[model samples]
Target: MSRGFVKESDQEELPIIPPRAPLPAGVINYVTPTGLAALTAELNALEAEKADFPTDHEGEHRRAVAVIDGKLALLRPRISSARVVDPAAQPQEEVRFGARVTLRFGSSGREQTFQIVGVDEANVKEKKIAFTAPIAKAISGLWAGETADFRMGGKAEKLEVVKIRY
Candidate 1:
């Protein structure tokens, strides 16, 4: 309890926990059946990781646990608030949440396909986009062969719904 008694080396830096995807305020947290499973799996993995942490290195172990706990704190709310929607139950005629849609862009006339998924489940590599995304929103109520104007990079591009599948 004396001045300059504490050493700088004794201080530990707090781990920086990354935030999950942005779910806008007032928007419901919707997830596909598979998406909920994925979240559950993630929670299990984190729990396992925490339980298996080596104890010999006390400081490192503590930090790791803190990081895991921080991550869990962020994840639990998402899991609890999740409203699972069955893709198979959605209407096959129009684009909606959990629907795999194929779109044909104007001018280039090129085709691309993506699934409208939950915010937490959105992965570009998997061709999954969030329901709140602009393109997804634009095509939400559209049926096959219907066109919608989407603003991409401040320019409007026409998107035609070529196909929709749950």
Candidate 2:
């Protein structure tokens, strides 16, 4: 029972499972129809990967399976909780979920376009932002030519809605 009696082989490194995109508590898991389809495709791909896991190298296969399992565990709940919202169903004149918005910064007079999407669907590189994002929240429900203030890193930035599209 002494610590000195324990064997080094008994100790093993634990697997690290990466966290998924944040979805704050009490917030609905809203997804665009395209977003839902993407998630479903990812799940299917993961399943196929797991099924084809190589068994020749026991340790490699085990580690691979563990990683796949971790991803599936996180993804399953999000998929189940998803509420699909069609972009075409949203108002074409006002910014809302699944709306592609064009904004102009008041200070710099620079224009940028971004689409408001679900958490899992958000990718800055793709010009898609989550509905929960500060910029998205500030402009949501706003119409063209409307302005809203957003605070970023202790500075307030004014954003003007230049255009909205489904």
Candidate 3:
């Protein structure tokens, strides 16, 4: 009953798992239902096939598990907090995460709309662009009606920001 003593059965130390690093801030993470489903399916397939890995392939199997664990870890976290650059909680200024920016080309006069999202949610074909990409970099902090130049395929291409939305 003394505070400094414990029964031998209760003296075992509990495992202390190290915490993962905090996720990046100020980035929009938009996950499509299809993408999440695919990720889940892939993990499932890995689980189902994991039993077949031979003892000789233990290294490869562990590597595979690590990869799957990393993917699942990222996927498991719900995008509950969208830390945009909006101190007012109503962003109406420079490009920030979760912003739908409209770009207008100064040279060709072409315009396009893109939603800036995190790396996991970026699909150029779907127009959900990654904030760290080259094209995204060109327009990340630009304001509406502003033009920015990009070099692609050895040619200088022009882009302009026409609009943005949350």
Q: Give the lowest summed-lDDT range of ten residues in model 2.
A: 6-15
The pairs that clash in candidate 3 are 102-162, 103-160, 104-160, 145-161
Best by lDDT: 1
The model with the greatest TM-score is 1
Regions more than 4 Å wrong, model 2: 1-10
What's each prediction's clash count? 0, 0, 4
Output the lDDT of residue 101, model 2.
94
Candidate 2 vs. true structure, TM-score: 0.93
Residue 80 C-alpha lDDT in model 1 = 99
On residues 57-105, what C-alpha lDDT tens digit does candidate 1 reach at each position?
Answer: 8788988999999999999999999999999999889899999999999
67 Cα displacement, candidate 2 (Å): 0.8
Using Cα atoms with residue i matched to residue i, what is each candidate's TM-score against the true structure? 0.95, 0.93, 0.51
Cα RMSD of all models vs. native, in order, equals 1.5, 2.0, 11.3
lDDT of each: 0.94, 0.93, 0.62
In Å, residue 57's CA in model 1 sits off its true spot by 0.8
- Report how far off residue 84 is in candidate 3 (Å): 7.7
Segments in model 3 whose C-alpha atoms lie over 4 Å from true places: 1-90
